[model samples]
Target: MTRVAVVGCGSIGTRHIGNLLSLGVSDIIALDPDSGRRDCIHQQFGVKTCEDEEMVWNYRPDVVLITTPPKLHLELAISAARHGCHFFVEKPLSDRVEGQDELVEICQSRSLITMVGCNMRFHFGPSNVKRLVSEGVIGRPISASLDAGQYMPDWHPDQDYRKRYSAQSRLGGGVILDGIHELDYARWLFGEVAEIFCHGGKLSRLEIDVEDSANILMIFKTGISAMVHIDYIQRFYSRSCKVIGEEGTISWDIHGALKFFTAKTGKWEVVEPPAKYTINDMYVEEMRHFLSCVEQDEATISGVEDASKVTRMALAARKSMLNREKVLL
Candidate 1:
């Protein structure tokens, strides 16, 4: 019975609470400033709720899940680390990297288990792409393209799009930061980025202050180059990736199949997800992995130190977009 405290009650927070319950971890305390959100989660899951952060510290949960907006992530995580609590923070570690080094130091000093929620790494399609690339199925990788886009309004039909954190600049809302899965997995597949150039901004009339689209080019240290396009203006949700190598190519579609083409064979092979796969399955598995790491006192797949690198990459992209010049990492 690992005690847990979830620090936000938005959609992601609600999903995590439900998943934690489904995984048989009953000791949960949900903290949210919104009374409506607190009441709703309590009614839905019967978990304890509180509006005060101090109350959560009093609960002395073994782990903390910081699902708040990006700007608030590092501050909350630092506090959790100071409390000697292992923590899981959502992606793009922070809107900026100002205090990340300190947070990493605190966690390292305490030996706390930390994980950043790059849940796409757990998704079947991306996971298989990673495995296939590592297995040399695509031969020596040379270049790749990654794309992800969806209408901002379609994200949550029940809520106003303008009210979401993704629509606010101060809250670290933008297609690049919000949809950083591409950059993360790009590094995972290829290698460290040597330089980056991005071109994008709020080209849509979505009533948001942040960039709604981005076209990023990355030069990897391993001599592999990749292009990534992310946008919040697509009428339909679309996510896919293609990797071209010396001998073949591989493609992955979130909604469809993973296809591999071999130059010698002249045939395309396909792989599909299990019959009962759902998007939420990845989130559940992500939480399960975090909890297992907590129990075993083992290092997580995406710890704070590794996530900080990605945050730096994201911030560099923003600098590139603002200055209209390529940034060297």
Candidate 2:
């Protein structure tokens, strides 16, 4: 069995551990500074728990899942790569503006496998969008828009939402970074983002320092324009995207399924293959792919380079928000 270490015991970290266990990975270790969190995991899974990050390195795990926080992701990932271990870091790459370039360089120099938590790409709904774009099913996507949002307090009723990483900017918690799922999907559907114009702030239902609403406009190299609306004040979680082309448009809803429209048909039709998924499904697939990469000695499914592009988009949006001017990225 491939040895793995989870460097955090927060909500997502626990989810990753559970998914890894479900995959029959017994050689697992958990490291969390919070004694209570570590104790709970030790009692739940009987996995070794340590209060030190160095113990994780000393454990000599073949893979490390850095789910600590965005600010610590680069440092942890670099350390893991230096130890000749593969790494899996969660979404939005890093919170800080610096270190991303160096992190990619280190991973490249060591030939280390790295996976980012852009799980939307692996989901059936968005995977079909990628397939359709590749096959020219939409006659070259020209434009697209996405809407993703949810109420913050509703997210964790049992725990204080303010204490989570998604609550503070220093922790890489905000509408843009935390709400970046749709941004990655749009990139997967179209091309690399050329420039971004955005306006966002903490002007919504939640009483937090971080933003609860964001509106972003992206320009792609292929002359494609896209808009994204993200908020953390919705009572119901909604994740949906619509792609428009010269011929027709295809829309996919994570809550529902796929809906198609054609000019000639003049009617909206639901066209989809068998698809069923959940948040945990992405976690399972992410861990499974990380396992396969380690076993086969192959490259990671999603590397630092891919995740950096998405980070650049988020960073540009943040810049736009602060400077009160459009930022090119």
Candidate 3:
């Protein structure tokens, strides 16, 4: 049995706990400062709960899942890695690039397996898009357009949107960082982003301190230009991307089918996800993948290196937005 300790028992953390239990993981421990959340986890999942993060060393967990805010990810992950524990950290890596290089170095030097919580890479739509692009079905991707938006209030109907981490800049919340799935999966399909130009602000009257919207332009190392739009004002959730290639085009949207157009066929083709596919399915698959990677001593879907690069790109976008200029990475 693998001893796993999960830090932060928030909404996402609880979801991971549920999936870990369903996967038959025994000897699970949860660490969160919030007693209410700890109580909920104990009652809902019957997992051991602790308020102290240092308890991980005593528990001797083989893996630690960091689901805390971006501000705390680096500190917790570094501590866990120092104890020779594998890690699965949530995305955006951290609010800034501070200590990221050293953290990556520590993980690599210790031969630790790490997986970032960018579940979008496991989504059926993006998975299929990667396959099609790799197969040359769309030829070489030349450009892309990606968009993701949802009303912040709708995100957590039970809580005040203004107080959530997504609405606070200090907590590493913003459309750019919170909705970073677009940037991440874009890189997964295209290549590394070399330059970025962005413009956005509290365009909407959202009662939050952070920017409510942003439009970013990225030039990948492959010279593929991509545009990304994210916001917190959409009444209905929306997430989709379109990739344009020399010979065809491929696009996908959440809860929708993949659409492709080829110059060879001159017709549109659609690829629908399996009828049973759901958003929760991605997290389950991600946990299974991470556990397997840990057991096999293999790299993860989004390892430390990829997480650091993605964080760099995100920070650059923030800088571009503030300076109102193009940032070259």
The better-scoring model by lDDT among 1 and 2 is: 1
Most accurate candidate by TM-score: 1
Error of 2 at 236 (Å): 1.6
Task: Provide the RMSD of all predictions against the true structure, rounded to 1 decimal.
Answer: 0.7, 1.7, 1.0
Per-model lDDT: 0.95, 0.84, 0.90
TM, every model: 0.99, 0.95, 0.98
Candidate 3 weakest lDDT stretch, 10 residues: 51-60
lDDT of 1: 0.95
Please, what are the lDDT tens digits per residue for candidate 1 over residues 1-329? 79999999999999999999999999999999999999999999999999989999999999999999998999999999999999999988999979999999999999999999989999999899999999998799999999999999999988899989999998988888999999998988887999999999999999999999999999999999999999999998999999999989999998799999998899999998989899999999999999999999999999999999998998899899999999999
TM-score of 2: 0.95
Query: Clash totals for all models, in order?
Result: 0, 0, 0
Q: How are the candidates ranked when ordered by lDDT, highest leading?
A: 1, 3, 2
- Candidate 1 lands at a TM-score of 0.99
- Candidate 2 per-residue lDDT over residues 1-329, each given as its tens digit: 68999998888889888888899988999999999999999998889999998899889998899889777888888888889888899887887658889888988888888888888777777777777777776677888889988888888899888887788877878889988888887887787888899898988756677888899999988899999999988889888888898878889887776877777688887856454546667668767887888788788756898888888888889889888888777
